[model samples]
Target: MSLDEVRDEARAFLSDHFPKWRKENNARGDLDFEQQRSWQRYLYEHGWGVPTWPIAYGGRGLGMLESMVWNAEKVSAGAHTFFNLVGLGLAGPTIIARGSDDQKARYLPALARGDEVWCQLFSEPSAGSDLGNITTRAERIDGGWVVNGQKVWSSGAAESDRGMLVARYDTSLPKQQGLVYLLADMHAPGVDVRPLRQIDGGAHFSEVFFTDVQIADDDLVGGPGDGWSVAMTTLTNERMSLGGGFGTFAMSFDEVVDIARRTGRIDRYGLVDIYARRTILDVLNNRVQSKLFAGQIPEAEGSVIKLLMAELGTLTADVAIDALGAGGMLAAEAPSAQQRFLGSHAMHIGGGTDEIQRNAIAERVLGLPREPRPDKEVPFKDQLRS
Candidate 1:
């Protein structure tokens, strides 16, 4: 089918099976796990879930443009905004780029069908901003490897089947050189998952503890020392995934505009400035998102896109508060209005903190001198963490 036809078909499918599934409303705040599975199965059957993924590994094999169209259509149709964000957007791409053939065959189909969820095993108590300083260790065992460490802020692990884990494999080597990336079995004997209740009163993110957990040799993504490069693939996918537009939610710019007009605030001097800023950001965000979908931007530019999104999100939320006044903070509203602000607040904390993203922009994108690090050369085991 042509790209346009494919997009229309996908939208029609969502309409029939999930008419209320708007982009922003798709998350549904952890309700109805069965329905989530049912919807995912419906998309998989229609070949719409992972459209641009390779066909050999249970994907639709569509082109990049088709995938972009599919994404845009999902948002336009108000399908679920956060459906399969981590699995399809981040972990799926990373595995395809660096995972072994066996890994692909074993995991891709399940992930596409939303049967086996995956979470990132990056980030730790001390390694949040300085990812290279991770102290998680994986010792070569008799047949595979034994992992013992802690990883926090792991999104979607509470229900995830597997985790893409990074650990220190060779302390004799340099910090970055000794790294190794592996697909950790979340249900392994020594693996423990603790759900963290966030300020939003949700448990989407979790802390994973691995104590002498074993991973088979085949679970490794790349060579032992290639973990750093392999990790870049995952982070690149994270930025791309985050920088894209959300189409699944029902409320959109058009709806927002309509509301402004109805409330007699479209041209109100104060509201006009708010709408103008949002309007400008909406346009710029779309353009950049298109570039990302087309693969026009380099991996390093991921930080730039992330920074723009963070700033835009902050501005948009401020505008909403100004326009809605007290009602914006209310927990109840028309079917969709209440959740709109809930989603906007999450934009700042998800993916990475705005401050961390700015550091990435400064050091990676602009080629500015990196911030000073006194422990850049320290051994992973020696770093003090309270």
Candidate 2:
């Protein structure tokens, strides 16, 4: 179908369906968990939930442009996409790229239909930026693997049904080697999730602990020792998703202008600066999407987008808070300038830290030399001992 047709269909569907669902569910602002699930199921039944995915996987098999149009129309209609973004943005793509046919058949339909939610179990207390330093271990056992470790800052983990987990399977090998990627059952016997409350008073992030958690051998996403490569794909997509302006704290140039005008800070915060930054972000996103549609990975470009997005989010929040002046100190029941300012800090830390993105850009994009690592060849066990 043409892009315009897709947009029209999306607008009509939302106009017809969303209000009824909202009214029936009594959803005023942000949706509750059950409301999000019901809404996603409603979209999926109508073939609009994941239109970019293949038809066999429960989508309409639409191309990138059509998917973008549908998303724009949904936003214009004041509808939210599926709340399980990790499932849609990270896990689903990684599975499509690296999963076996059986894996895809078993997982994709439920994921696309929003019957199951997924989360990332990559970072740990010690491995936030330097992911290669993770101490999580997945020991080989009869009929499956046994995991014993903890993951921190896992978004939506408390609500997830599954998680993409990277763990050390053979610690005798180097830090980046002898690892394995597995699909973990979040409701397994030994798995525990503890939500971490943020400064914005939201418990959107969590700490996930595993103690002798059993994962079937069939849950492996790739061959043994391929964890690093497989995880790189997920991380790259994560950077792109975060940088594509899907963030909770994203503010458009028009919104900033309106806020400035309302607060009489139109002259204090330069509208020109906000407009320029927003334009740059849009151009960067377009370039990245074009490259992706052309079947290119654009890994380095993802880093650039992530870095710029982090900076822009912080800058926008700063402007909003400054414009609000003393009024920012007062808390509102809904998300306000103060909440956005507090939440913007998470963008810098999640999807890899700003410093990590800068280093990646410097080395991979600019052809600069990599930083020295004396322990590059050290075994994982030995590194832990030190």
User: How many clashing residue pairs appear in each of the predictions shown?
Assistant: 15, 0
Indicate the worst ten consecutive residues by lDDT in candidate 2.
Answer: 240-249
Candidate of highest TM-score = 2
Model 2 vs truth, CA RMSD: 2.2
How much does each candidate deviate from the true structure in C-alpha RMSD? 4.4, 2.2
Off by over 4 Å in 1: 8-31, 247-274, 289-295, 322-346, 363-365, 372-386
Q: Per-residue lDDT tens digits of candidate 1, residues 229-286?
A: 9998888777766645552222444555555555554535644554565565456556
Model 2 C-alpha lDDT per residue in residues 107-197, reported as the tens digit of each score = 9989987899999999998887788987899999987899999999999999999999999899889889978999999998999999998
Estimated TM-score per prediction? 0.82, 0.93
Cand. 1 TM to true fold: 0.82
Question: Alpha-carbon error at 117 in model 2, in Å?
Answer: 1.3
How much lDDT does candidate 2 score? 0.82
Off by over 4 Å in 2: 23-26, 243-248, 333-335, 384-386
